[model samples]
Target: MREAYHKELESISEALVEMANLVGSAMGRATGALLDTDLRLAESVIDTEGQVEELQRNLEEQAIAVLARQQPVATDLRVVVTSLRMSADLERCGVLAQHVAKLARRRHPQHAVPRDLRRTILEMGQLAQRLMAQAAEVLITQDVDAALQLERDDDRMDELHRMIFQHLMDERWHHGVETAVDVTLVGRYYERFADHAVSIARRVVYLVTGEHADDYLPDTPVIH
Candidate 1:
């Protein structure tokens, strides 16, 4: 029974890793499409959203099966609950990517974001993607150290997001109001993407250590 329970745990973790990879790719492609003005890439991100949702559903079903069949207790119960939480986070990440794609589609003929802000937003998105991917690896391998290192990456994403916000606020103060709203919205999307990645990392911590990380916020303070 112990061996069977361990196998079920491993299966649950594997499913989570797959879900994380899908979310990471979606975020990366969304930012890439936005920066490059590639409508096709944006569309790809939009199209893949359904698959992410389906995967989340499947994971939830599998997790429920584990709970029903194994009746996990203590640490095992934490694994089941953490899987559900992480799946929800991954689903939200997909939704954020869809929003980015919608923005990209809206501005197909011209660039939606300003040139100065593009690089930073892209960097933030990339960091979020990296965190998602690394968090999956850490979870699958049960590497607490690697999972903890994701906090640093999340910090970098937060810094980029704050800088983007500052740029938007500066523009709002000095420049006209036309672009500020859209820019702020875009920054918010990216920031929320990073925030979701941090949430996934925290869930992984709970899965491994059986305790939730209290430090949910990234290292950097809000600048704007």
Candidate 2:
């Protein structure tokens, strides 16, 4: 029975990794749809979001069952609880990807991103995907160093998000208010997606090290 309980714990970890992988792929496809204004791809992303949601629900159910039956302790307990939070973050990441896809579908042939800003948006999307992929690695490997690196990586996404707002607020901007709003929303979605990736990585750090990321002092050894 103990062996079975441990196996269930491992399954939870696997599910979290799977969630991360799914959300990462969703963001990548959503970015393509956004850049190319591909309605079909956008529709594909929108339709598949239910898969992410279903995965989250299944994970939660399994986690709750483990907690009730096995009553995990110490690291085992952390694994189950952290997996729950990480799944929540992954679910949110999936939703953000869907939002990006919907924006592409809404804009249709016109393209949601203007040509001048497409490069920045593309960079944001790529960064978001990379961060999520790294987060998944951290989840599976429990590599605290890689998890910490995700925080640094998120800085780039934040920079790109600021760049988008700067262009929108520029007095010389040619795009109308509607286009500006669309760009702003899209930038926010990418930024939040990166944030969720970082959050998941942080949770992994906690699971591995038993140290909450926020508890560290600026020059602490664990962080470096």
Candidate 3:
């Protein structure tokens, strides 16, 4: 029975990893659609969001079952709770990607990204996409070290996000106020997408080290 219970727990983790992959792909495609102003691709990315939602619902049901039937304790208990939190993070990542796709769809024939900012926006999108992919890998491997790296990547996303504001503030800016508002929203969407991915990684760190990533110093020797 204990063996079966543990297997169910593993299944929940597996679902979370799958959610990561789903959102990662959605973000990549959304970035492509945004950059190219492709309505078809944007619609496809928007459509895929339902899949992410389904995965989250299924994961929740499985987790609740484990908690009620097995009554996991210690590490097992932590695993179940963390899985729920990570699932929410992954689901939010998908929502952020959909927001990107929606922006692209709204812009339609024209580029949502101004010409000067295209390169910066592309880099931000790719970085956000890669962060979620890395988070997925961390989930599968349960590697605390890899999970920690997501934080650094998230810092780079923040840098790119700030760069967008600089462009809007420049004296020669020509994109107009409407485009500026759209750019601001796009930058925020990518930034939040990366943030959710990092959140997943931090939860993984907690699962492995039994300490929050902020508090746990992997290099320090324990006094006890």
Best by TM-score: 2
TM-score, one value per model: 0.87, 0.95, 0.94
Q: Write the per-residue lDDT of candidate 3 for residues 109-176, one digit (tens) a residue.
A: 99989888999999998999899999989989989877887787688899999899998999999989
lDDT of 3: 0.89
Better of 1 and 3 by lDDT: 3
Best by lDDT: 3
Model 2 residue pairs with clashes: none
Please estimate how well model 1 matches the true structure, expressed as its whole-model Cα lDDT: 0.78
Give a tens-digit lDDT track for model 1, residues 61-138: 988988998998987898788889888888888898889888888888677777877788778777777888787787
Models, CA RMSD each: 4.0, 1.8, 3.3
Better of 1 and 2 by TM-score: 2
Backbone clash pairs for candidate 3 read none
Error of 3 at 171 (Å): 1.4
Model 2 lDDT tens row, 1-224? 98999899899989988988998999999999999888898999999968988999999999999999999888888788888988988888889999999999999989778899999999999999999999889887888778888887788898888899889989999989889989988999998899999888888777777777777424455433
Q: What 10-residue stretch in candidate 1 is worst by lDDT? A: 215-224
In model 2, which range of ten residues has the least summed lDDT?
Answer: 215-224
